[model samples]
Target: MELFQNVVKLRGFLGRNADVPPSDGITEDAYTILHLATMSGTWDIATNDWKPRIDWHRIICPGPWFCGFTRGMRRGEYLEIEGELRDFEQDRTVVVVGKRYPAKHLSYTVHATRIQQLERPLLVVDTGDDG
Candidate 1:
């Protein structure tokens, strides 16, 4: 019996191009990073309407083959991704009023095993007439 499992499936639009670094190290050749955005709506009681919220995610593509597959993908493309969540502690410096403080933050990244492109973004054409 397996008590622990980390799996996630999401469909969203690509926010930017995949980040692929030069294959200088063994680990570098095995993974690439992608930024994706997912949108969800929630009811706003004050406005009596639904409000849309966007959530951004960082995805890590494993394997050189998969990295190659994502390298050609462009922004504004819709995609479906399947992966496991990976979380780590990241240290950063925060500055406030010329004062610097060290902080530790927990960051989560998706390690993708499968990815599929759904559709490309639509293009709008303008006709110069306003009626």
Candidate 2:
């Protein structure tokens, strides 16, 4: 078995239709981008009410295979995705008043290994107990 693992599984809905940007002449650069959203609820003791939270995720699939399939997917379409979390670093140079400055930005994205569309979502039950 492996000693280290970086796996992420997310079940959520599509925020919008999938997009495939123009390839940058690199074979491995061909990929699709998907916006996914998930929800979580918690009972607030102080407010004595339930609070809902929504989390958005950026998903990247490395291939042109899923383009057609995901292109037709509409917003709020339920999906289950399995992948690993990846971090990307981007560098840029800026020029201001004849001076040059370098900048670096870091971003996190989920690299999907598998994706499936679920016809129906599991039911969520609300228990009155604050426990």
RMSD of 1: 4.8
Best by TM-score: 1
Off by over 4 Å in 2: 21-28, 91-103, 122-131
Cα RMSD to the true fold for all candidates: 4.8, 5.1
**Prediction 1 global C-alpha lDDT:** 0.87
Q: How would you encode candidate 1's per-residue C-alpha lDDT over 1-131 as one tens digit per residue? A: 78998889999998998887665642644788899999998998998987999999999998877767887778888999999999999899999999999999999999998999986667586776887
TM-score of each: 0.79, 0.74
Q: Stretches of candidate 1 above 4 Å error?
A: 22-28, 120-131
**Model 2 agreement with the true structure over 1-131: per-residue lDDT tens digits:** 99999999999999998776544532545778899999999999999988999999999988666654565677878999999999999998888999999999898999999999998667888876898
Best by lDDT: 1
